[model samples]
Target chain A: MTETRISRRFAECAAAGRPALVTFVTAGDPDLETSFEILKALPKAGADVVELGMPFSDPMADGPAIQAAGQRALHGGQTLAKTLDMVRRFREIDAATPIVLMGYYNPIYVFGSERFVVAAKAAGVDGLIIVDLPPEADDELCLPALAAGLNFIRLATPTTDDARLPAVLANTSGFVYYVSITGITGSATPNATRVAEAVGRIKRHTALPVAVGFGVRDAATAAAIGRDADGVVVGSALVAAIAASLDADGRATAKTVPAVAALVGDLASGVRTARVGAR
Target chain B: MNTTPNSLRNGPDDRGFFGIYGGRFVAETLMPLILELEQAYEDARNDPSFKAELANLSTHYAGRPSALYYAERLTEWCREKTGGKFGAEIWFKREELNHTGSHKINNCLGQILLARRMGKTRIIAETGAGQHGVASATVSARFGLPCMVYMGAVDVERQKPNVFRMKLLGAEVTPVTSGAGTLKDAMNEALRDWVTNVENTYYLIGTAAGPHPYPAMVRDFQSVIGTETKEQFFAAKGRLPDAIVACIGGGSNAIGLFHPFLDDPSVAICGVEAGGHGIDVENGHAASMTGGRPGVLHGNRTYLLQDGDGQILEGHSISAGLDYPGVGPEHSWLRDTGRVTYVPATDKEALDAFQICSRLEGIIPALEPSHALAQVLKMAPTMDKSKSIVMCLSGRGDKDVFSVAGHLGETM
Candidate 1:
């Protein structure tokens, strides 16, 4: 496989002796225009990689923060096409920042898998993180997305045992998302000691970079996790920041983009200095 | 054109797919647990001790082999409506007479036993109309395990009596207020709970839906309804009934009754979906097969009521039990393969049947199965008296009497 933008960015971050700061935001959140502003500002705000959430009506695995963000985006008339359009527009200004579209499978299934892959590739999407499609459902969307030359990143949860880690990692690319906690997003706080041990175990099996997410909230937690992980994914916290900055009617205020950007900037600094004076 | 499969019962192949419908479409955190469940269920299926224990509970605890009643008065009423030119004999698989007053206990007992076998100490379930909640609570109480039931807030108000019954049985009922505050939301909450409490908790799904093994496992446990009906009807008439009908809410009772007779080409099967006002009304009915298309939700790819963006639409129905946006995955495959016919019955028609069956047979039917009774009322009068139709009386009307009275504008 050719070296994609995601792998290249991870390598660059590794060369700097720091983990990559992976930031997530729901596309078209609050409204379409404001979401685009947030997406465009993420790179400058120190986001090494971006995960754009494709809003779906029923996000079973998500907690309240991300779920409400998706609802707001959907309420703003965001569709899979519009989400891709946001990515396409983002690519116009910044071609080096890797963007991954993350959500459940139904939206893509409804968009027609073959058609979605072509459209997503054309939109300059670097990877995908479909929460519901496991390795058992490889033929459904995973294989097709890979065939279209898009990285299909698979999640390796704490529950993924030694026997099962191989299957989860087989077709995975870009990076292995190690869910630090065994719960939904923004729920329980993960133990840093356990997370480091898991990252080491996964690294022993493959040469791929491992990113830890789920329950990562602030700069302190990001630094604690990023010390061992190749990438630190902070999603619910950023979406929560967006929620906190919204108006009472749930409309986006002037501070929405700034709030999210400030949080990402803090998390990015923490991730950059995580390996400092250690090793 | 769909070719008929040689055997309809052999489905959900090794990977838990009924054709291309069912699979483990879940989070990576839940994948290993689902695979463990699949293996555990397989072992229990082949173990005679497990079979014997379930059979014992079915007979002694749940009161299995619920009567196959001849519904003579209902049959006569239909004949009178048709001037004796039609009206086939009407029979009912009296599942409402079970211990928990519904067919839900059959599957609950089996699942609870499996939970115990898996050393899971905590039990959780999601319910729409509370029949499954009551059944889950009853089984949890029986096994001395802590139980939690997630119900939609709307259903909580409508199904007050059942809510109280679950509480009386020592189970915690959490009303989910998300989405439309209905079954789908409750299911989403339950999935979240299971994902959060993965270690010692077992999600006892209430229907033949959800991911791979659940659809197949629930179907197997509930299959006793059809197995008993087949034998009883054979003994009563020395042959099988010509037709069978049941309401579809995640299609548990319907699949249970339909699975045992799928190979019998001589018998016809029909599933009735809840049409709140009518299917033509947007988002006004729960007829996933009739008005919806294939989409993945609640862990399986099936026919779902969704919009152009693949966002699931909240389905409406007078009966809370039937108010889910998606049907079971096996039903989706069956609909695609033409093995069974799916039809919709509006609220008005079901209400009319609800009153008619109550007056004629003195049996007030639950609104869920009243939809099925509505279809039987339609099909029975068009057939000859020599033929017979069996409908699953899946639940009693006691739980729905309050809602029925309110709908009828009568103060209770």
Candidate 2:
């Protein structure tokens, strides 16, 4: 197992005195070729870490935007193998950016968990964020991924009180994804004051970097969360940008890559400018 | 006090797993809520007041101890129709006589009580055939909790009477139009709503499905049907019946009747699923145990109708309640362990049994239990006269009258 790229990426962002900007894209939105092109374009567009979504038939935790993106990806014949292939392709050009594959766990379970983990490491994937696998069931994928040198990120929500935080963070590695809101992604914006408090509480427990996501649709919201978190994750909003850039027939337009890149660039600027005075 | 038979009751271990099936396969956002629910259900299970109040409601409000009547005429009709090779006695565990006209109310009452204890202010549920929706709406109205029921648009059209019944019970019915407009889609929408409103809402799942605590809790509530049948059968015949049968939609009613008899080695248990057109077609039948493979869906690992790509396929059934791609995870466990036998009842078979039972026994059963009766009608004629079978008539047929009329090409 190779060393994870996530920890180094966060350390690099810390040295640069800025919160890392993390972007999310479905692996095969519209089609495989266009999706890989968008993936390659994300780094130059200022994304520090890229979270690629492996589309599943049912993404229960997602909002309408990501759900639609996944539906498009699935309609275009995206599978776990294809998602890994896209990662293999993205690693060819840029080996520095940490790539986290995020989705539900059924596909991996169907694809055989051990086989998927080995394949993911070989494909240059850095981390995993399976939304449905809680810490109580960590041995299902988390431990295996950790053994394979991939960070298995766990999500802590507002409902996660002090009594449950320890278990939630027991085996979590590389980073802790603090879901900024109680609802699905893109549904409601998080209160930065509450998020700061949650972040402070979580930092007291683990030394892992904490990234905030959910309901972060624009640069302004990203900046607000970036003030207190180690990283700012913008997922549904970027997926929505890709959706908006699609042609009338739902195919990728010429502006698809540019549209996603422009949003990531703005978000990157927001994260970079946050917490200058305090830090 | 752990009324389950010692042999087959030790499932779901500590983590709510029944063998390889039945775990909390929900989103991380719902983990806290699920843990809270698990604790709350445990506390309520131990509280005497909770049991007392639930019992009082069962006896006076929901009409518990639904009759176990000998279907003498139906038994005779079967014997005559099947050439008298077998003259097995048939009995009907009359869950249809319950206040909401189904076994669904049993689980609803128990869940609403748990919801009240947990301090939840609102309730939400998903319905397929609308029996569970009506039952849930009835309890919400009784407990003064604002209720919302998600029903597939297709089911709302086919089960209009139940839709009207739910509305009359003061529940707001939201028609879900996604993913073939069926039970599975309705559940997906309900889960979405639950994940969105996790603070003040209690998702009152109507079946023995979903994540942990649900399959077990719903079975505990519905086990009243089996418990009552056990007592009544012993009182009537001085012994337990040779076999018990029930239909498996999400398998709530079937598990209700089967769980109590699971330890009795001499008592055979069979679950009948709706085989819509046939089991061979790509999109036909809700016979997950017979025609499907084990997979994860709606927060539990169960036998589901899916394709090679792991995409869940829609199931077809004449009964809206049984038209789901997945069975309850516990049923999958039971099937694999060989504790229970699961079979399929085709549309034509259930329809003919529906008409025959109505004519012979003067009871119009819901289409769900008609599937069970279809299987019983076939199996009863093959058994000796000394042997007996009890079928759970899970619901009344009033709500299904319109659909039956349409299917039979008769005008209302």
lDDT for each candidate structure:
0.95, 0.91
**Worst lDDT 10-window in candidate 1 chain A:** A270-279
Question: Model 2 lDDT vs. the true structure?
Answer: 0.91
Q: lDDT of model 1 at residue B190?
A: 98
Q: How big is the RMSD of model 2? A: 1.8
Error of 1 at A137 (Å): 0.7
Tens digits of lDDT, candidate 2, A1-279? 234688888999988888889898899997999999889988898999999999876677888899889889988988899999989988888889999999987788878789999999999999999988999888789999999888899999888889899999999998999998878878898899999999999999999999999988888888889988999999989989999999898999999989988998899888877876865
Position A20, candidate 1: lDDT: 94
lDDT of 1 by residue, A1-279 (tens): 579999999999999999999998999998999999999999999999999999999899999999999999999999999999999999999999999999999999999999999999999999999999999999999999999999999999989999999999999999999999888889888899999999999998889999999999888888899999999999999999999999899999989999998999999889978888878
Q: What is the TM-score (0 to 1) of candidate 1?
A: 0.99
DockQ of 2: 0.60
